[model samples]
Target: MAAYESAIQSRVDCIEIDVSRSSDEVLFTLHGRQGFTTDIRKHKF
Candidate 1:
């Protein structure tokens, strides 16, 4: 979240991020190469 805040503070036109929703219905950013294909719902945060 700090990174997002920093980007906003920096006045950047756009920011890129990876987002995923867990089975528990939680929303958060997903990082790493494996995250692209991995199903976060199967894993616990």
Candidate 2:
């Protein structure tokens, strides 16, 4: 979690995170196959 916070604190303009789509057309941000970070998927429009 600190890694992600540090990345944000660095004022990065853009970030690249892996995303996957669900059957309901929802998008999720995942670091790897079994690692998931924050629940950004719920905020997707």
Candidate 3:
């Protein structure tokens, strides 16, 4: 959410967010697949 705010403040024309589903079927947004801090699929949200 902070990233989106920052982009809005910077007057960005467009923004992108990566959405993924966890093992528990919880949906969330992230930046990218590469260099992920943790495996969302393995964690139960």
Top candidate when judged by TM-score against the true structure: 3
TM-score of each: 0.48, 0.40, 0.57
Count of backbone clashes, every candidate in sequence: 0, 0, 0
Runs of candidate 1 exceeding 4 Å displacement: 30-45
lDDT of 3 at 12: 78
Tens digits of per-residue lDDT, candidate 2, 1-45, equal 555567699997666677899999999876543556555557966
lDDT of predicted model 2: 0.70
lDDT, each prediction:
0.75, 0.70, 0.77
Clashing pairs in 2: none
Deviation (Å) of 37 in candidate 1:
16
Query: In model 2, which range of ten residues has the least summed lDDT?
Result: 32-41
lDDT of 3 by residue, 1-45 (tens): 887888799997777777999999999987643665665559885
Worst 10 residues of 1 by lDDT: 31-40
TM-score, cand. 3 vs. native: 0.57
Query: Which parts of model 2 have CA positions greater than 4 angstroms off?
Result: 1-3, 23-25, 33-45
Clashing residue pairs, backbone N/CA/C < 3 A, model 3: none
